[model samples]
Each structure stands twice: as structure tokens, then as C-alpha cells.
Target: MSAIFNFQSLLIVILLLTCSCAYIQSLAPSLLDRNKIGLLGIFWKCAGIGE
Candidate 1:
């Protein structure tokens, strides 16, 4: 039960993170490009959206 709850929370966190990253990418491509951010860049690249 506790494990399930933790998993759900982790999943929600990941979803939120992904959505926020997408929003940021849409809003500020230059910032993300210039800084070469790590996790978000990896996520977008894996999603086949980013370079």
C-alpha cells in the first residue's frame, strides 16, 4: 500500500516536471538552448522534439 502510494506520487511528480519542461521549451527556446540544460534537454531529445 505504501509502495503504491509512493509510486503514484513519483509518477505525478514526473508528469508535472515533463509538462513544465514542455511549457518552458515553448516559451523560451533560446534560454534552454543557450544554457544547454540537462534533464529537460534529455527528455525533449528522447521525445524527438529537441535537437
Candidate 2:
């Protein structure tokens, strides 16, 4: 049960990170923008949207 909860929490974090990526992209492009692009794609394929 704990393991399953942990996995769910991790997915939530990923979704939040994806949201941040979108926010950052809209706010301003930066060095981290490159990595966020890849992370966004990965999260979309591996998880669901949170925002």
C-alpha cells in the first residue's frame, strides 16, 4: 500500500513539474527551457495532466 501511494505521489510531482514547465515557457524562456521540453514530452507519455 505504501509503495503504491509513493508511486502515485511521484506521478503527482511529475505532473506539477509539467505544469511548471508550461508556466515557465509562457513567462520566459531560459536555459532550463531545453530540458523542460524533453521532460514535458516524457511526462505526457508517462503520466496524466494535472493543470
Candidate 3:
């Protein structure tokens, strides 16, 4: 049980890091307004509206 819990915790941490990295990557100013668009895209995806 403890091992399973530890694995879940690690997975959660990894997921959080991945999402944060995606968000940060989408914040690039030189992307020519792509960041804001990507932000909306992320929201839609999270909401299951897209993809």
C-alpha cells in the first residue's frame, strides 16, 4: 500500500511538472501571440472541448 501511494505521489508530481512546463513554453513572447492562443487551447483541452 505504501509503495502504491508513493508511486501515485510521484506520478502526480511528474504530471504537475509537465503541465507547468507546457504552460511556460506557451508563454514565449516571440511566438507572435501563439502563447495566448495556446493558453486557450490548453483550457479547452482540459475541459474536454477539444481533442
Candidate 4:
């Protein structure tokens, strides 16, 4: 009985981790692009592109 309980808890933890990872993975690209754009903006200003 204790073994079965442990297995169930382990399964639940794995499922939660997998879901969270997937959620982060989905958001990662947008987060990365935002960072990239921020860097690009700094470079653009340094280069005086709009001036």
C-alpha cells in the first residue's frame, strides 16, 4: 500500500514538472525575442540610425 502511494505521488510530481516545462518552453521564444529586440535597440541607438 505504501509503495502504491509513493508511485502515485511520484507520477503526480512528474506530470506537474512536465506541464510547467512545456508552459515555459512555449513562452521562451517570446521572452527571447524581447531580449533580442532590447539589445538591438541599444545597438541602433549607439549607431545613431535614426539621426
Tens-place lDDT digits, model 4, residues 4-49: 4798877776566556544544555353334335644443332232
Clashes of each: 0, 0, 0, 0
Highest lDDT: which candidate?
1
Which scores greater on TM-score, model 2 or model 4?
A: 2
**C-alpha displacement of 22 in model 1, angstroms?**
0.4
lDDT of 1 at 15: 68
1-51 per-residue lDDT for model 1 (tens digits)? 553479887777666667766677788766556545676466555223422
Off by over 4 Å in 3: 1-5, 29-51
> Model 1: runs farther than 4 Å from truth?
1-5, 37-51
Indicate which candidate wins on TM-score: 1
Error of 1 at 14 (Å): 0.4
Tell me the lDDT of model 4 at 48.
Answer: 31
lDDT of 3 by residue, 1-51 (tens): 453469887777656655664565566424323434655555434322211
> Which regions in candidate 4 have their CA more than 4 angstroms from the true location?
1-5, 30-51
Better of 1 and 2 by TM-score: 1
C-alpha TM-score for every candidate = 0.58, 0.48, 0.45, 0.45
Reference-based TM-score, model 3:
0.45
